[model samples]
Target: MDNRNMSDIIESYLKEILDQKNQIEIRRSEMADLFNCVPSQINYVINTRFTIHKGYKVESKRGGGGYIRILKINLLTSNDYLETMSEVIESDLTESEAHAILEQLYGNNLISAREFRLLVTIFDTKNLSTCEDLNKLRSQMMMGLLERLAYEELE
Candidate 1:
């Protein structure tokens, strides 16, 4: 039996389609039916998995003929991704959000494994438990990393 849960299976299915093309239009009800799940489950997966920060753009339409459009944003080309990612970081960032950004960078080969590990270590809340505002610290570290990436390309 597969150990992965419903959400993982559904996400993989959608990504499989996305790999073939940059965009896909899906009906929530149909996706739920195909996966033997409820429509709300489909909504949950889309909302969480397909986010702008994670390199996906999602558009949803509600009602009888409603559909969800997912576009895999290909901003990974060139150093522009670093600049774009820098702009997206807010004043505060949760650990999960930080990991998402790091994972995206590593997956896109923008950062080497060593750099990825260094960032992950620096951003770990456990290492910064003495600080009252972990999120703010994380945001600063992320921005610093983005700046370093841009500077690295200049060398």
Candidate 2:
């Protein structure tokens, strides 16, 4: 299977388990064995899929008793979640980082499908090739777009 499929399977498995509990602790090697994949595959799934932007906090221990703990962060409100995301984007913004934020917002239902597509198109690196300072432009554009969307949601 492709890496994307493997990642999706791993992510789904973890999310399914997590649904039964607020937190889960698992050994990386054990999970790898269960999925018939390498330990790095588990790490890849955890790092990319279970990120802070996705409302997960991950902690790991090394050695014989090593375990990876995944905790779901519960944001009090949508505004609070948006505020937390805004803080995360504090200065510079990269293409991948911006895409992650957009994905998070869409996953949490904070943004609609149309909005997500529009934002994705606007922030696409290729679309912004005309800009001299890509990072700065991306940061400004994302910030402005987010602020406007937040305001619209408030109205």
Candidate 3:
């Protein structure tokens, strides 16, 4: 199987468990053995698929009896979620970072898929003039969009 498929399978499995438990702790070796993949593959999935931007907190210990813990953060309010997204934007926003934020917002039902796709297209910095500071521009644009959405939610 391709690495992407493996990552998707692992991510889905973890999300399923997390949905029930809200948190989970597991050993990397055990997950590797179960998936018939290298330990590093598990790390790859965890690092990319489960990130703070996606509303997950991951902690790990390294040793013979080490464990990796994944926690699903519950943002009780839209303001809290917006604050987290602001932190993710922190000073600059690359195309990929903007895409990640849109994906997270869409996944959390904060924005529609149509809105997500629109934002993704609009944030494409390649088409813009090289003289423009894409990172700073994108950061400002994303923050404006997110703030508008948050305000809409309140009203």
| Top TM-score model | 1
Q: Across residues 69-152, which tens digit of lDDT does each residue of candidate 3 receive?
A: 999877687677887787667668878778888887888788888988888888888654573688888889888988888788
- Kindly report which residue stretches of model 1 are placed more than 4 angstroms away from their true locations once superposed: none
| lDDT of each candidate versus the true structure | 0.87, 0.83, 0.85
The best candidate in terms of lDDT: 1
User: Could you list the CA RMSD of all candidates, in the order they appear?
Assistant: 1.8, 3.1, 2.7
Better of 1 and 2 by TM-score: 1
Instruction: Report the CA-based lDDT of candidate 3 relative to the real structure.
Output: 0.85
Better of 2 and 3 by lDDT: 3
TM-score-sorted candidate list, best first: 1, 3, 2
- Candidate 1 lDDT over 102-127, as tens digits, reads 98889888788998898888888899
